[model samples]
Target: MSTEQVEVLVVGAGQAGVAMSEHLGTAGVPHLVLERDRIAERWRTGRWDSLVANGPAWHDRFPNMEFGEVDPDGFAAKDQVADYFADYAQKISAPIRCGVAVTSVRRNSGRPGFTIETSEGTVEARFVVAATGPFQIPVIPPIVPDSAGLTQIHSSSYRNSAQLPEGGVLVVGAGSSGVQIADELRASGRDVYLSVGPHDRPPRSYRGRDFCWWLGVLGLWDLETPPAGAEHVTIAVSGAHGGRTVDFRELAAAGITLVGRTAGHRDGVLTFETDLAANIAAGDASYLALLREADEYVDRNGLDLPAEPEAHLLGPDPACVTDPLVELDLAAAGVTSIVWATGFTTDYGWLQVDAFDEHGRPAHRRGVSTEPGVYFVGLPWLSRRGSSFIWGVWHDAKHIADHIVTQRGYLAYRAPRPPQ
Candidate 1:
């Protein structure tokens, strides 16, 4: 295989990878982006057809390119998001080598660069940006029994409820992914079972104001500087989808059964905690109280506000009248489909770098990793609460790019090769 050298090499060309590449280009850095498949393949292939962004279109864009005239509160379809990313790569003229699968990334011993081994070839770079996101890895809980004989699939593999086995569908995990999947499955005429878990609660709207509008007033999006020792706050808040906080009362009213975490599934018998209903109720209350506090803070601060319409906030009153944790034998109920919207994990086995923490995330300070010249962007939270969001990534990308330029002396160092 032929070897080529560049100043920087970016792995994975998703939203994060493309954003990092754009920033690097703005800084006049000589870099190349390696993607195992075409850019945004995850979005193109992993998401469901009815899957719309829980957040509005405004939050789904990348650096400098606004998702113009799109629906404000309307969710952008997965295809639209993929198309937007493709257009973004084109507009930025990102130096991307598509179909180049980075098999491993190791710190070049005794050298000031990193070695990126790919199926295409190997290349060395003084700087590496691991924009491969956390969602690449799917977490399949070990507790799910193999003999259950139900068609089980993770959120990444689930494309639609049509693929579900003919029967009631159980969606485990009440996070954004799980809730949305459950809602979609229910709408598709399936008896949907939702398993609730500990989740952050926010009103669809507070005081007739959209939650995002309040987030903006509270500096949620503009928080570029993270609080001391509060790095996880960024990731938690950005990945959070307040709209996924469905009205349990509404769900119950609609005849959907809520359940506790799946303790274990075996021999087609699904067991749920009896306290599942109480747990969901308490969790929803806690979330609502937190949102109220956030609203109060915004009012007290007297921040400038926009004229956007408010979202409808559902009260804690139970929407569903049925027992929360009613377990049904899947074999008896004829529930053949199980959608595991449990959540995602970060898989960095292919990345041979040393910057990852025990959780397999790059140990970084504001996008700058411990390994010199290595950086990351579009993490759940890179800087503040919104850093992982599309709009948030722009601010972060600019900052990381600026940091890279300042440290690498891009203004002084001439590229060994001309621009491609």
Candidate 2:
């Protein structure tokens, strides 16, 4: 029945949590970070075996910590990233209590704080910062049919093709993970059907450099997302020979049958809308717009950057959809496996608060939660588009730390440090 109290509680231990802890430490604030598993647990168990970061290691680290002395432009694989986070945790001596699953967070009536009940015990937190990184649970469509007898998997649990049953694979979602997994499966001689949706189609390299380089110089990360929709995005990056891209066009060209977004499913038959052309066009438009933005940025900055190169791997042409698949008979198509690359949604089920919206997402202006003494970090568009990224969430961490110190009078309770 062990219980403790802390001035602040950060509810995760990934990059966001670790970085937030570092910021608190720098502010001389005594905070405890609790995680259900080890630090970077999501990166360890959530990703596939062949997954690599969408961006380079040189630019992916948090403030004051460098990915130091590594390949400046190389993409780190899954294990490498896990190691990186482990190393970062070690470097800062982050105050993280592993294997502590927080099961409840309720308001306290006597004071401005939260009563957090965890697997280990309980925490009385003056201010609660929820850094519960993205992808709380796999977002499978409500329309998914009874895949009774078939081996089904969400992309998060899928490791490699060898683990799948010997038959065709139907991958739903055309995002990075979907595309990459489908491509890999197809390469390994499995007949793969990739269901497409509106996805960003940025090239692997724009000029003579990786597209990430251009994104930094173009000031795009600082721009506001349009009100209509989310900014075009994908982490379908690779570090193979000259780099492998996770483009739908490339996937289509590589013999993976392209289908439209999953509409619904009934009696082993999956229905799809026939809008493949429109989705492909939307992706192409985003890419072209990005290139134009980069070109204008180069001209404005007077930077001597090279011109954009020739067509990369047959850009997504709508003409590829001549024989599109509208309804797929799962059994007849020999689809023994269905990998739901659908996406993810955050879960605040245990956080007993009324701060969430209709979509079950926490309503926050920046990182400040609608509920007092509570805050959210590492969410898409939290402060900017990049706020969801490892390198971007630091901005919110610092802001939250400052807010706690200034608004909550948290720095008043910081414990004195011993002589170093």
Q: How do all models score by TM-score?
A: 0.85, 0.91
Listed per candidate, the RMSD to the true structure in angstroms reads 5.5, 4.6
For candidate 2, the per-residue lDDT at 259 reads 89
Error of 1 at 149 (Å): 1.1
lDDT of 2 by residue, 307-391 (tens): 7545423444644476677898988989888899978877888899878888877888788988887889988878876686678
Which stretches in model 1 have alpha-carbon errors above 4 Å?
A: 221-245, 290-322, 410-420
Looking at candidate 1, the ten consecutive residues that score lowest on lDDT are 232-241
> Candidate 1, residues 1-420: lDDT per residue as tens digits?
678899888888888888888888887888899988888888899887766665666555764677654666656777778788888999999998899888888887786778888898889888778778768778778766766677888988998877776888888877667766777777778898887755554555555455666677666666766556544211112122334445656665666777877777666688876656565656566556657666577568775544222333454545332444445688777778788876677777876667778776679988898777778877876877777677777677788878877877754687688788
- Clashes in model 2: which pairs? none
